[model samples]
Target: MKAAFLVPVLAALWPAPALSDGVAGEFDYYILSLSWQPAWCRTTGDGRDAPECQNGSGRDFVVHGLWPQYERGWPDHCETRERDPSRRDTQAMGDLMAPGLALYQWRKHGRCSGLSAAGYYAALREAAEAVRTPAVFDDLPRDIALPPAVVEDAFIEANPGLTADGITVTCKAEALAEVRICLTRDLEPRACAPDARRDCARSRVLMERIR
Candidate 1:
């Protein structure tokens, strides 16, 4: 009788598991964002003291994130049972993105991936590797002004399967900012969602020279 009473008391005292705001691993696709380091340095990183902005960092197009997306919207900060990545795990991604961004991406986007931290990062690496950066941007000797379409064309030309609708170029403060590419859940190139297909319309947007 005493043992039965204790069971009831314990059940009353224990906390219920927290409910996740968004379901994990249920997104329709992914958006792989690549940031132009020079443009970022000139516009934002100049104030943040980011290592990518330091002289000789030699970074051009750097991984921004691999975000899960819906056909109409996107998920963020979803709760998950998987353990958070350790410092070492975030640091390992420094070659592709900043350690701080890696941690933030894991908290905001990675949690919704349904995979454990290790699996999410591995998938991120694979997704980035699947896309090829246009070689024309490499060692660009001087700043140039061009339509955003030109940048998109360069990317589509470099990656055979990537089409006009599969990628979008974004500009910031009249400068080239990022190139966002849509991919299938399995990492194949695909047309972007209507919302994701909003390309920057800036004609003669400045693309800063590589630092």
Candidate 2:
């Protein structure tokens, strides 16, 4: 009886098996080899017939554009919450970076215009490091075989109801300088400001309060 009790306790105390370095290598290869996609945004309706519902409130998920607005801020010329989803009123977005593109191209040079070969090489090295290290993104039990397709699918599964394409990308042409602005003080209330009102009337980026 004592032996049976001790066995169960020992099993419960046992640590999870360590992941094999070989499996980690395979996952790393796939993650680095996968094709990188440019930033893009999209929207989806509830498939309802109601006209009001069709144009009603919807969520926006930006995969990349927010980095510029988030990491730094919006342009100085325009004082507002540049990437607030509620302000868009029509779409959301996501950007898929190429294998070595993420580190070099993300929020650098005013929005991923292009990175030099040296930058690309450095990004690749960084990608390798991300996989080996353990964190929210790191896959445990390193022996598990991971494919690029599988990783992509898993990302989708993780974010239920939200689509990946909702993220949008910006070109180097816009070339807006980065500056921080609050949604309420800088963006929301500014809607009524003379200049902001003019731009809002024409473009109407933000009209209602964004929750």
Candidate 3:
């Protein structure tokens, strides 16, 4: 009887055989690829500063369910996970620009958890920044000056996480001249100098870019 009881106990203690090959692989990939933190991503409609990064978990579902995976499907719906460490590092560094600690948490937990994908991407970016290496700033043409309103629109288009009124980009040249594009500090008026504003017009900044 003791042997019988012990046998049952041993069976219980023994790990259950992993699911079948197909199921096992699917679950493993799903777990690794899925974005567990849905709340981490920010939505376009809601004017949230530092919108949560789209939860990548939804993309895993699409991949599993014979759905099409596209960039359009990611924002406000799914998070993107970069399988490449270099790409992941790029994203994690971007996460540092978020306005609040919530993003910091998202960046932190996203990498540490079993759920992979975007989290891993973020982790890589974070790791890259920690190294304190200088990023090579790719130079662009300085002559191109878009209209103030257009520049404002472009700024908003570039960073969906900032407030709806990213920049009060007036069409009038004089008004445009007064309009300063701040970096990172979006809401603060007079935050950017003339030179910085011109630079903002040229590039897609993670924080606030004005015209």
Candidate 4:
């Protein structure tokens, strides 16, 4: 799901009472969004450096952004304009996300996170590393057809405690888009919000190969 970013004036429009959890430290949980590199590159027709398109980048599932979410809704652009990640950090995570996305994630979602910029990205790295990718996704076959349920089950089988309810398979047209995984603040698999769950009814979705 696309995260909503509220401007400072507009952000204040929602009262503190309406705001969920501690100012930042205590969001309900986290949404570790794993975007399919091939799907994005193929569908959007543009991405990061030549290495990523050439398959030299080792990452299969790229970090879309680690968003801090409320059970019912979410927040964005929490920090004032003064707050930004250091250049070193921006450079470090540049490849993990596409160009501009690293800084964009920090400015939009990461800053709202009670965690500091370094800590937020560190948590993101840990979360991404901890989840084991199913072999099929690791070396995706071109245009391979599979039900969304099959994709969810593959993740459930590979990761302990993860259930179909906690995994949402997002699609773009007929192409597999992303696997949005639900995680507790402590980074454990938790059931996703009913609204956040996948509602796509296609019988089969195509998994684009990362060539």
Task: Give each model a TM-score.
Answer: 0.86, 0.18, 0.18, 0.80
lDDT by residue for model 1 (1-211), tens: 0000000111111112233246778788988877777776776666777655676666677777788888877777888899999999988887676667777778878988888888889988898887888888876788988899999999899998999999988877688777899999898999999888767777767888776
**Model 1 bad stretches (over 4 Å):** 1-21, 48-50
**Clashing residue pairs in candidate 1, if any?**
none
Task: Rank all candidate structures by their lDDT, best first, as comma-separated numbers.
Answer: 1, 4, 3, 2
Model 2 Cα lDDT, one tens digit per residue, 52-164: 12322221111121111221122211222222222122111112222222322222211221223333233433332222111222323222222223332343454333223
Which of the two, 1 or 2, has more TM-score? 1
- Shift of residue 145 alpha carbon in model 2, Å: 3.4
lDDT of 3 by residue, 1-211 (tens): 0000000111101112222112111111101111111112221212343222222222100000001111111111123352323444433434332122223323332322333445433432333222211111112122234444554554445444423332333222222222222222112212322222222242222211111
Whole-model lDDT per candidate? 0.75, 0.20, 0.24, 0.66
Indicate whether candidate 1 or candidate 4 has the larger lDDT.
1
**Model 1 TM-score (2 dp):** 0.86
Model 2 regions lying over 4 Å from their true place: 1-139, 164-211
**Distance from true position, residue 70, model 2, in Å?**
18
Count clashing residue pairs in model 3: 14
Error of 1 at 63 (Å): 0.6
